[model samples]
Each structure stands twice: as structure tokens, then as C-alpha cells.
Target chain A: MKCNRTDIDTETRLELEGALDALTAPEIRPIFDKVVTDGRKRVTVDIHKVTMIDSSGIGAIVSLFKRIKAEGGQVLVIGARDQPLAVFKLLKLDRVFGL
Target chain B: MNAETKPSDAGEPTVTHVTFRLRASLAHRSLAIGLVSTLVEHVKSADRDFRNAITTAFGEAFNNVVIHGYRNRTDGMLDVEAELGSDHMTLRLIDDGVQADLSSVTPPDLSTLPEGGLGIFMIHALVDEVVYDSGTRNVLSLTKRT
Candidate 1:
């Protein structure tokens, strides 16, 4: 996954591309964690270009959500489609994220 | 190609299957998906939802074999056979690896938004049925209705 950071006054948006699975999940886990730890006020994750996502990818996002929410910030997941969207809907993360 | 199709002259639905053995490694996960995708694609009449389910569920099942059953061991054996039926798909997965302790593998509580324990849960939810047998060899039979 490729993460492009956009820092704004209210949020930090990471435009991620490629497949998020067991192979790529590890590479992004630390980066996501650091983004939260660095006090990113609001997180917007764009998964529009993500082709496939497995449990590992979902785990990284959930972990990121937990940390950011605990730190009094919110996470906004945008533009999820296809397999990734189905996964989010099945797991009911869509409701959690209010997507 | 193990995906031999039996065509019937009497208007019977043709049954076809393709089999491949995979090294139980994460590196082979994409190959597993690609193999199943080809099989799913062969069924041209199936709708988008059905194809998507088979693709996602098969990926989850293959991941379990490699990550949970084999525990990332490259030497572990996982044999995947996928069949394209007229209205559904069947995947027979045989793995020579450590047996999964099924008793502990239960559905995750969705209220908690747990991450790690959701793989098996998602697999069960996405597929029509999941049958697991453990003995001399571990077998996971997954069926998804198209």
C-alpha cells in the first residue's frame, strides 16, 4: 500500500493504493500507528483505489481507529468499493465508521 | 489442468474443477486468489454478487490454511480444488499442517469491533457453508451459492 499524507488544519488524509492483505498489512501497520501517535487530529483514509483487502488489512484499520478515537480524534474512511466495501459491510464496520 | 469439464449431450449442467497445490506461505496467497478467480470467471452467467462472494470467501479460506493451519511454514502442504457448478461453487482445501483448534475458533463479538478474531467469522458469513474435518489430514470444504 502507498500512503500519501495531506496535512490540513483539521485532518491528515492518507491516500492508500494497492491491495491490503497479509503481505502488505505489516508495512502499513507501523505507519498508521505513528500517524495516530503523532497526534493527527482527524484521519481520513481514502481506500478508493484499494483493490483487495483481507482481515489483516481490516485489523490495521481497526487498530488505527481505536487509537485515534481513544485520543479524542475521529477516523473517516472514504471511497471504499468492490471487495473492500463488501468486507466493510459484512463486518459492519460501515456502520461503525458511519459510511 | 485439473479443471476438467464433463459436457453432457442431454442438457445437463457441466461440472468442471481445477486443482493446485500451494506452499503454505503468504506469498502464494495471491496465486490462490488468481486460480479461484479464473474458475469463477469461467461461470459467465453467475451474477456479480456471487462471483464476489466466492472470490472473497476463497481468499479467506486459503489464508486460514497458510496462516493458521500452516503457521507460515513454507514446507506445509495445501491442496486447493475449485469446482464451478451451474448455480454455486465448491472449494475443497486439503492441508498437511497443524490442525486448527476448532473449539477456540468461534465468531467474534461484532459489538466490540475486534480485529484478530474476525477472519473465521467473516469466512463463515461470506460462504453458504463451511465444513471442517481434522484427522490424518485437515480438510476444509467451503461452498458458496451463486
Candidate 2:
């Protein structure tokens, strides 16, 4: 998986590509940690390039969302399609994450 | 991959059975999922939703075996058998790792926005039936019908 981070004003945009499964989730842990520690006010996660996603991939995003929200920050997840979108809808996270 | 086609009656749909084995680890998870996805494409090539459901459920099941059953250990192996027919598909995953307590798994409350527990839930929701048995080896069967 490839994770790229960009900061614009107070928002942090994360562009994720490739399969975001168990094997790749750990590789992006540092990005998740930085987003939380930095306490960005707005974070946008783009998963359009993510071909597949499992529970572990979802966990990474949910963990980041929870921590950011706990600190009064906002997170927006955009560009979810195919298998990843199906999973998000199945877990009812589409509405929660405003996908 | 070993595949065979079963002869059927005049009106019965022919069933194609395929089986393969892989190392039970995250590294091989995508390979396993991709094999199943290809099988699904061969059977129901045009239905994107069907392909997505099968692949997603199969991926989660594989993840469960590697993460929960093997406890992240990579020395084990996973055997997968897929039965594909005209209107349905069934995937059986066999493993000798730690047996999962199927009774203890429950759907996570989406209101809580929990993350870790959705694996089993996704496997159950995306398929028509899920059957799990633990004996000399653990077998998990997931079936989906159109």
C-alpha cells in the first residue's frame, strides 16, 4: 500500500492506494500516528485508489477517526468504491464516515 | 490448483470444484483472495456485486484464519476448496491452527463505530450461509446464492 500525506492550512489529506489489508496496514501506522499526534483539525482520507480493504484496513481508519474525533477534530473519507465501499456499507460505516 | 467438473442430470447445473493450498500468513492473503476472485469471474463474470461480495467475504475469512486462528503465526498452511455452480458458490477453508469459537462471534454495533470485530460480521452478512466445524482440522464453509 502507498500512503501520501499533504497539509493544506489545517486540513490533512491522506491519499491511499493499493490493497489496504493486514499486510499493508502496519506499513502505514506511522501516518496514522502522526495524524493523531499532530491533532489536525480536518483530515480527509482518499481511498479511491485502494483496490481492496479488509477489517484490518478499516480498523486503521476507524482508530484514526476515533482519536481525531476524541480531540474535537473532524475527518472526512472520500473516494471509496468497489470492495472497499461494500465493506464500508456492510459495517454501516458509510454513514458514520460520511462516505 | 486442481479443478474438476461434475456431470449433472438433464436439467441440473454442472458444478466445478477447485482446491488449492497456501501458507497461512498475511503475505499470501491477497494471492488466496485473488484466486477466488478469478473463480468468481469465471462463474459470474458480469456481476460486479457478486464478485465483490465473494472476494470480500473470502478475504475476511482468510484474514480470520491467519490472525485469530493462527495467532499471527506464519508456519501453518490453509487449504481452500471452492464449489462453483450456475447460480451459487461455496468456499470451504480448512486449517489446523487454533479453532475459532464460532458461537462467541456477534455483529458489532455500528452505532459504536467499532472496528476490530467487523471481520466475522462481514463474512456472515455478505454470504447466504456460514457453517463452521472444528475437528481434526477447522473447516469454514461460506455459501452464496443468487
Candidate 3:
């Protein structure tokens, strides 16, 4: 997986590409944690280009959300499509994340 | 990578006994998923929704064989087979790893926003029928009817 990080004002936008399964989720967790913990209060994860995702991927995203919320930071996920989007909806993470 | 395609008595194209190895790593899991997705695409390319369900469920099941079944042992041989019929798809996954106790397998509470334990849940939700055989060999039979 690849992430293009950009700072838009106060929010850190992470545009994610590729699969978000067990294999790729581990690679992105640290990057996501850094983006949220590095003095960034507002964050947006754009998964428009993500082709696939599974339970492990959802776990990584949930972990990121919990960490950000614990630190009093707000996180938003957007632009999810295809198989990854179906997974989010099936698990109702889309509603929880307000994506 | 071994596969065979034939027409059954019903005249529907049946992709039979498409078998592949299940290695003990994430990269191999990804490779297996890619192979399964390609085969599924050949049978259900026009329907993206069904294609996604098959791929996701099969991926989870295959992952279980590596992680829970074999305990990440790379030396063992594990094979998964698939048969694509016109109305449905069936996957027969066989592994020589430890047999799984699936009586307690269920979807975790989604309200809690769990990190793990969602793989089995997703499999049951996506597939039409799933049966696990723990006798002798650990065989996972999954079918999705469209």
C-alpha cells in the first residue's frame, strides 16, 4: 500500500492506494499513527484508490480511530470505493467513522 | 497453479479443481487471493458485487488456514481447490495443519468496533453456505449462489 500525505491547514489528509488487507494493513498502521499523533488534531483518510480490504484492514483503521480519539483528535475517512467500501459498510464502520 | 474447465450435464461451464498452495506468509496469502480473484473474475466478471464477496470470503478462509491452521509453518503443504458452476461457486480448502474447532465461530459484536475476530464473521455473512470438516483433514467448503 502507498499513502500520499498532505497537510491541508489543520487536517492531515492521507490518500491511500492499493489493498488494505492483513498484508498491507501492518505497513500502514505506523504511518497512520504518526499522522495522527504528530500534533495533528484533525485527520482525513481518503481511500478512493484502495482496491481491496478485509477484517485486518478494518482493525488497523479502528485502532487509528481509537488512538486519535483518545488524544482528543478528530478523524474523518472519505472516498472509499469498490471492495473496500463494501467491507466498511458490512461492518458498519462507515457509519461509525461517518465516512 | 493447476485448473480445469469443463461443461457439466447442465451445460454450464464448470471450472473444476483449481488448486493452489497456501504458504505461511502474508505475501503468499496475497498471491493466493490474487489467483482466486482472477479465477472468480473469469466466471463472474460482469457482476462486481458477487466477485468481491467471493474474493473476500475466500481470502479470509485462506488466511485462517495459514495463521490458525498451520501456525505460520512454511514447511507444510496446504492446498485449496475451487469449482465454479453456473449458478453457484464452491471452494474446497484442504490443509494438513491442526484441525479447527468452529463451533464457537460467530461474528463479533460490531458495535464494539473490534480490531480482530471479524474474519470468520465476514465469511459467514458473504457466503451462502459454509461447512468446515475437522475429520482427518481440515476442509473448508464454501458456496455462494447467485
TM-score of chain A of each: 0.96, 0.98, 0.92
TM-score-best of 1 and 2: 2
Top-scoring candidate (DockQ)? 2
Better TM-score candidate (2, 3)? 2
Real contacts recovered, all predictions: 0.79, 0.90, 0.76
Clashing pairs in 2: none
iRMSD, all candidates:
0.9, 0.8, 0.9
Computed on C-alphas against the true complex, the DockQ of each candidate is 0.83, 0.88, 0.79
How does model 2 score by TM-score?
Answer: 0.96
Relative to the unseen true structure, what is the C-alpha lDDT of residue A21 in candidate 1, on a scale of 0 to 100?
91
Q: What digit string (tens of lDDT, one per residue) describes model 3 on residues B1-146?
A: 78887756585465565777755566777787788777775565327788889889988887787778878577766677887765677878888888885534766888988999898888888888889888888888888877
TM-score of each: 0.93, 0.96, 0.90
Model 3: what is its DockQ?
0.79
Compare candidates 2 and 3 on DockQ and give the better one.
2
- Candidate 1 per-residue C-alpha lDDT over A14-97 given as tens digits, one digit per residue, 9 for 90 to 100: 889988998889999888978987999799999999988998999999999999999999998998998899899988899888
Give per-residue CA lDDT, model 2, range A55-94, as digits (tens): 8899999999999999999888999998899888888889
Q: Which lDDT value does model 3 have at A20?
A: 85
